[model samples]
Target: METLKGKTAVVTGSSRSIGRGIAERLAARGALVAVHYATNATAAQDVVEAIGKAGGRAFAFGTELGHEGDAERFWAEFDVQRRAFSDDGDTGVDILVNNAAVALRDHFQDATVADFDRMVAVNIRAPFFIVQHALDRLRDGGRVINISSAVTRLGLPEVIAYGATKGALDSFSRILAKELGSRGITVNVVAPGYVDTDSNADWLRHDKDAWEETAAKSVFGRVGEPEDIGDAVAFLASDAGRWITGQHIDASGGTRM
Candidate 1:
């Protein structure tokens, strides 16, 4: 339907998995997508090729988050690349999806200080500053969707620290929504549960018992897919979601319900 025709979107950590799904969906809706990756130039380019083959426009950008000046550098790179695809001089972003994060599977007792710091830096600090740095480039009516985890609401012993970071992101979104309301910008969070992505493939693909256990968390008796979460994000980025902001929309397929 081209609901997002003539829009520009940036999806972080979009080289693979859930981020890739979101990037593709936004492109399919007619938005020119900037797929951000921390490393792995090959993988990022693969995503761009896939999108192009599917009749979508996209470009890949590599920037390591969780470091000083990274966010500013990211925008600079985006601005240069965006001009290549844009005929008009408009380099502002219409949608910003902060989907990059670091997940440390360390329990409260097992978590190391280093692990916690890395997670906090990547998951919380990066997104926080990413948004702050993007304020000037974000269109007045832009959409900000920060990907969170269902673990924030549910009890996940393995990723307790990781979940906390997402909780913080949710809080940030809520306040930012109110703060940006006057500008007509919408900020929201999308939390996913037990998604079957490459990050989980090592455990899920090898062990049938473990896979079943994870899938059973959802009332639908199945694990969530990248597209499932992507669909939710697409809705939030659409004009239909204009009335909604400062909300946490669960894309977990009724997990633990």
Candidate 2:
């Protein structure tokens, strides 16, 4: 069933990994997807082509986040692509997925001020302002899904800054849910634990023992996959998840449970 037949979705950092998975899944469900990327134009185009080959609609938009006027730049490019993609001249979006993020691995003492600021800019500030700038474009009864991390609950000293940013993101979702409730716009967070994406290939894929330890963290005895997180976001972006908002859905495979 094409539940999202006439809707439009915007997924940030969707060139590869989890964001790519989410964008593909949403497009598969018949949503006209705007695949947002930071720098990799080729990778972003690959995503758009893949979606088209799958009989889904998608377009790529590039705007580097974590810098001045990042949100504005993204929206400007998004407007252009959305207008071109929409057949009925409808520019309103039905789903907004804030999946773009930067992961910083550093213990508190080794974490530099610049590193902290960069993390904040990408993870927290970007999403905050993106939503702020998207209010007019987002239609009533829309969905806002923020991609968060399990480190917010699990004490991961190595990624303290990254975890802190997700913590703030969760708080942002809770508050935004209330503020947007009247418009029937549901806001929520999906926190994934130890997904095996390219970003973690160096440590998770290369070291067998290290991989086992990370896999053991989940009750399922396996590391999470990109589809695991993508499926969770797909549910929230659908009508079935209408009643679920102002909440955190842990797509962590029972990690730390």
Candidate 3:
């Protein structure tokens, strides 16, 4: 019923995969969505086109995160695009989804300093500064949804650094909720287990034995789809989730349950 009829949303790393799912769902719910991409303009444009084809509105923006001035550059492009698209040239946004991240699969001893630093830069540092810089542009009663991982809860040793970064994001969401509560802004985390994305296509979709083993992790006895997490994010971004904040929702299809 177009709950977000006039709202504007920014979803980072939405060129493809789970982030694209969230952006598409938000657009379908009648929000003006800005689909942010790092290096894949074509993929981002494809997502925007797909949303448009679905009778939704979306635009693409490019900004490489995890670098110096990354947040500033992203906002600069975002402001320009938003103003161009807004009917009254308003630049304020109602939803900010931090879904951009890097996954490095390495054990504690095998992980290099460069790998750790890069993960920290993309996963932890970027979101922190993005929120800090976006506060002014984010209106009262806005939603801040951070995409996290089930690895944080499962303590998977392969992606120790990756899990730690998401753990930090969850903590950040809790504290940020309190800080922004007075402004009526809600902050929360949506943690997903192994979803069948291209990133995991090799193991989860291609290899039959690997797929079966992976699916067994969830009590549902199946792999979680991108839409599963996307729908959850959509609910949290909607007004129906007004009373929900400072929380972590496991959109993992009962993984490890």
The residue ranges of model 2 lying beyond 4 angstroms of the native Cα positions read none
Each candidate's lDDT (Cα)?
A: 0.91, 0.94, 0.92
Q: Give the TM-score of each candidate.
A: 0.97, 0.97, 0.98
Q: What is the overall TM-score of model 1 with all chains considered together?
A: 0.97
Instruction: Provide the lDDT at 143 for model 3.
Output: 98
Residues 3-37, model 1: lDDT tens digits: 89989999999999999999999999999899999
Candidate 1 lDDT (Cα, whole model)? 0.91
lDDT of 2 by residue, 40-136 (tens): 9999999999999999999999999999999999999988887776656677889999999999899999999999999999999999999999999
Q: What is the lDDT of residue 256 in candidate 2?
A: 80
Candidate number achieving the greatest lDDT relative to the actual structure: 2
Q: In candidate 3, which residue ranges exceed 4 Å CA deviation?
A: none
Considering summed lDDT, which 10 consecutive residues are worst modelled in model 3? 81-90
Evaluated against the true structure, the overall lDDT of model 3 is 0.92
Cα lDDT tens digits, model 3, 124-175, are 8999999999999899999999999999899989999999899999999999
